[model samples]
Target: MDTILFYTPGTCALAAIVTLEWLGQPYRLCRVQKAERQSEPFLRINPRGQVPAMLVDGRPLLESNAILAHLVDRRPELALLPRHGTWERDIANQWLAYLASAFHAAFWPMLMPQRYTLENDCQATVRQAGEEAVRRELRRVDTYLEGKDFIQGTRPSALDAYLHAMSRWGNSLVDMAKDHPNLWRHQKTMARDPAVRFGTAVERGEPPPEPHALVGHVELASITL
Candidate 1:
């Protein structure tokens, strides 16, 4: 399979990278810069111009959850997800939906208050609301993780990768390792995986051109296809 993942550093796209690493697939990585993401060429690739866009055999796929699902679907033996129609699969979907919708939504106002309100005076209030929502959600998730080594029982699944990438976002709001012990424990466990480590380092600006890496910047004007 000819695969290429477009990503911005420190984004949820890291979850896709982690999935790819775990799949042990040979896929290319294309670093998408902020300015280039809005360009015409990138927009052609994904109208939304979002990161975590994967081109499978040059066919584009958007959304982090969808992309991760596609990867797992390709290799069911990897068991990143439970078998279809099972209660475990249903629970996994529930968690993924919550992360994609509620958990991710809580960070927008805190990170980009201007997008939520026009009144400069109310930006702080909006941001504070976002922080509280995030904290509450994190607490709930931590409670759910009370005795689990991984989000889905003991085995590391795609949910674990998503949490690994997303829990990092909370570190800016609280001492993740201290305030969110369970979540931090999950993060720490994923960190030990060689795939997670490599993906994290590269996303944090480590040297790339590793296996399956197609070294190139996302440039609109210069795009060949």
Candidate 2:
């Protein structure tokens, strides 16, 4: 498959990138500079100007959760998800929806409080509200992982990668290490993964190490839309 992932560093795109690395499939990366994400070039790829968009065989796939689910469907042998039509599958879908919707929305005011309010003085309060929301959600996730190593149990799935990515933002907003031990453990363990490391290194503008499946990194100046 001709696959190319368009991402901005530190976004949820990291999860999909890590999953692709684990699949060991030949692919390429397109790093969209944050300042230029909403510009014409990226807007052409995803009208919403979102990160975590991809071109699979020249077809566009947008949204992080959709990308993760597609990866599972593409490589079912990995068993990253449970079987279809079962309660397990429904529960898994529920988690994905929650992460993408409520969990992710909670970070907006914290990350971009200006969007939430018109008054400059109100931004701080808006941000605080977002932090409170994030903390509450983090506690919920911690409780969910109380007895399991990952969201779906012991075997590492794409879900863990998703959690790891979102939790990176969550960790920055709160003292995850001190307050949410279970989430902290999950984050640290996933960070040790070579695939996760590769995604992180690339996000930092480093070339992936030798003998990797990554075709190469592309900048807007270097490639056509």
Candidate 3:
């Protein structure tokens, strides 16, 4: 398939990047700055101007979860997902929904406060609420990872890739390592995984951080959501 991934660093595009790397797929990566969302060219590609939009065989696919699911289906050999009739499949779906609807959606107001409210007072309130909600979701994820290596039992399924991408934002917003040790460990592991390192490095415009630097700092309160 001739694929072109329109992406921005530290955005949901990381999800599709990770999936592509895991499948060893060859594709083009088009960098789009978040601030350029209003540009005429980007607007034509995706009126929403959102990152992680993939053009597969000339057809555009928006939304990270949809792209990931499509990749898993197309490249079954990667086995990012599980077969039908298994508990693994159910759990994978659960995590995917939780990430998209619960965790990822919480960032909407914080990222676009003006869309949420016209009043500055209301905007701040909404943004703070979103931050707290995201913290709560992170706590839930930490609990889920207490005794498991990945989201769905032992293996790193599609859910783990999605969650890993979602959690990367924690570095800018909260101290995930301080709040959740298991989750922090999971992040480190995924960051070092060959596929993840390659894709993240490409997206970041530099090499992946050293493995030692993966230990997250405890200064979470310093973040302003």
| C-alpha RMSD values across all candidates | 2.2, 1.5, 8.5
lDDT of 3 by residue, 142-193 (tens): 9978988887656676677788887877767777778778889899988777
Descending-TM-score candidate ranking: 2, 1, 3
Model 1: lDDT of residue 102? 86
lDDT of 3: 0.74
**Can you write out model 2's per-residue Cα lDDT over 67-125, one digit (the tens) per residue?**
98988887777778877788988988998899899988988989999998999999999
Model 1 clash pairs are none
Best of the two (1, 2) by TM-score: 2
Model 1 C-alpha lDDT per residue in residues 1-225, reported as the tens digit of each score:
888888888888888988887787777788888878998878988999888898888788999888988999888888999878899899989988888888888888888899899899999999999999889889988888888999887788999888778878888899888888998898888888777887878787776435533334443454444
Model 2 clashing residue pairs (backbone)? none
What order do candidates take by lDDT, descending? 2, 1, 3
Ten-residue stretch with the least lDDT total in model 1: 212-221
On the 0 to 100 scale, the lDDT of residue 143 in model 3 is 90
Cand. 2 Cα-lDDT:
0.86
Give residue 200's error in model 3 in angstroms: 1.7
Task: Quote the lDDT for 75 in model 1.
Answer: 87
